[model samples]
Target: MEADYQPVSRTDAECLWASVRERASDPHAGIFGPSSISWKVNRESALFLGAGRAALLQLAHPWVAAALDQHSNLRNDPLARFHNTFRVVFTMIFGTLEQALAASRYLYQIHTRIQGAIPETVATYPKDSRYEANEANALLWVYATLVESALVAYECVLPPLSPGEREAYYSESKTLAALFGIPSHVLPATWLNFEAYSRGTIESAGLGVNDLSREMAHRVLQSKGTWVPVPGWYRALTTAWLPERLQEEFGLAFCRRERDAAAGARLWLPRIYGRLPATVRFTGPYLEAMSRVSGRGVGALTRTSNRFWMGQPRMMFAERGLGDAVELPQPLQ
Candidate 1:
């Protein structure tokens, strides 16, 4: 590990969790509730449109790419990776307080076991430089990509957020970042600062797409071995949304044909997407959350959608050992 890098200690995680939990107006609604900009923006199924872009951006980070290549089964079971990623994230955003906290602890536990050295020198990180999943900087980068990409995808089909709404959304997202064990001190103070940080990081040597990253990107975009391969236009949009440097590094072609396809999507998607039914337009977790708020509990239709989103009828927190019985460390006074 680098001498300057600080992994998120148990103390840090607990303190952040307590701070966020204490501020929740509706514990049953989780950290961010129905009124939150996070829900208003993230509830839309259209955000999945930017999922490929987010995955590619994450792979551009050498540490992230190395971690996934070395420790994850992403290549063998790409759908599992997708389901797992959304499972944790949706749980954090839409699950009840206990569920969200359980998911946080589960994620922290998983991160504790993921530490390895990069295989080759990539930009600022030297070969053999160590990476821990709980490292603040790396976690922050991944958090930023999700936040930015969600907004980018949301705006594609819906109206863009006002400047104030963007700031509020970023503010709420810091609590989600806390779940990742990233310190508030390490995060950008505002949405503008966050944007600047994201742009700067992408342009800097901190983000180096290696051969492994390129392979991972291909795997994520191609969906090989799956009955449902990614659509050509969606792939084009993903490639076009990336930074030009990263597009080149990943060898994604944005030829005239791809450009036309992407353009056509930008023209047609919004019109068609707006007319989708609520069950189809909103994610399962979001619907489940609404059910909770309405006192209806999770319905059969919601459970079916949950299976599609998370590969299970429910989050299965207890089955996964992330239940109420799992104890959290106490925060310091």
Candidate 2:
């Protein structure tokens, strides 16, 4: 496998930002507009169904697991971590151009501070092998998991996208990858290529789950900070959906009862969930975008839902300051 672990350079990031600004015809619509498949797929509240799958997939990557274990407050405040994550991501996808740019800069700042060594020899990485949160390859894997898991969740409760739609969505997602500072040269050229990359990575040693990864996986699935405990059916489905190798590596139990529960959800969830009202079915960020376009402005209901998704009543961008001017590391020679 390619071993380039370089973080994004300041020059590259600036170029990407310029391209995004040039392409944004409607600044209020952010990167993807209302008609985008990204909006259509991500707008659904049902994407929450894939949250566990995405988390577990991320944990399976030793670099991500190590970075979180060493630098994140996930064990102490998973909900806050989760909320902060969604806040930045949703802002990039659904906020205005200024908000999206601010979110990207904020995220870039956070990533620059997160660098460490692997605690133990896991998979191909030796003990004390370095990891950086801003590394393009690791970022790509995390991005892939989110994109694939969202599709999995969306299809679980809604009509599956056609082949052309899936390709279009993947094409658009390259922009999201650019926002993360992943170099275009390193990204898969097409959706089919992306699927192959995901499958190949899953089978590679880089994704071996170590002790910390297993512990973190369980902690995330069992976390109950403020919110009610994760339901059994949800856990069952998460475990069932995971690649069999990773499931064994994580030691997640997928007994017949769990299997039955996951099966039942697959059988009935789509039929019932498809009938829900738009307000209940769609995400707050999408609703807020709609309100922005309609000139109605965000309302109390949207604000309430925003709190659920973003942990705040509205997306907050840092005011212009030194911190807002994210200081990237010098480019790798």
Candidate 3:
């Protein structure tokens, strides 16, 4: 892997982004082009900071919560659960066309096996109402939560993007949802529509807080069942960063002290993080993708910085293996 790393010139980065944007109009445009807004926003490590928030928001939906409670083992091995989700998300954002398609195909197969009835009724879904991961509405809910949470995380941990950039990012994100077999019509047509959808989901009575959602929320906040040790500040930030609606639904109380800590961290952490060299800010997959497109090796500074910035360097290196090129199936017609 070290042999493949090299410095990326500004000229190369611009060229790659330009090519990707040009191809964005092609439905058949490969998984991600340089012009892809996802690359611009998702390449930051700060995105992972929102993982707990995303999980909590998804669990707020009783059907989504019930599905995990019955068919998933999030508490049994949270690291693996997170890795599975993160692998698919990152692959879509940073992997080559073949890798993105391959990862999506794998996830689709996993979703096929995750269908069952909601054990208890919440809102319109009766106790026996069936829930399938592949169901259009259910899939849309999950997709929207993930996208919204990611953007929220981005805003919290990085410099704000222009409204236009955010819109372009949402448009690019739909392409990703499509890769998961969600029909285009089922997805929100624009960022404004998505915002409305998100607001409704958060405020809906259907998104009831239940025993299962509470338990899952606890595990996420405490970082239980995961291999990595979540920093105390990050855990606090997760609670503070969560939407007020979710905080109330989950029954999380932030004392004045905790709120102050969260506020200070939010203001300073991203500013400090932004000051880090690009080598320190980006992960290996992103670096490799830039190398592949620009025909240049990522710099040694990247590996050197990983040792300094990574909480667990072993896990960081392991992720590179996950992103290595893989055999890909043909695109769905």
Best by lDDT: 1
Q: lDDT by residue for model 3 over 183-211, one digit each (tens)?
A: 66667889999999888767767677777
Error of 2 at 180 (Å): 1.3
Q: Which tens-of-lDDT digit does each residue in 104-128 have in candidate 2?
A: 7767767887888888888888988
Better of 2 and 3 by lDDT: 2
lDDT of each: 0.83, 0.81, 0.66
The alpha-carbon lDDT assigned to residue 235 of candidate 2 equals 95
TM-scores, each model vs. reference: 0.94, 0.93, 0.80
- Total clashes in model 1, counting residue pairs 3 or more apart in sequence or in different chains: 0
How far residue 116's Cα lies from its native spot in candidate 3, in Å, is: 1.1
| lDDT (C-alpha) at residue 184 in model 3 | 63
Residues 1-333 of candidate 1: C-alpha lDDT, one tens digit per residue: 333587899899999889878878888778898999999998999888988898889888888888888778777777777778888888889988877887888788888888899899987889998888888888888888888999999999988999999999999999999887889999999999999999998898788888888988998899973555899999999988898999899999999999999999998999999999988899898998999888987788888887777767775452335432322221100
Candidate 3 local lDDT, residue 267: 86
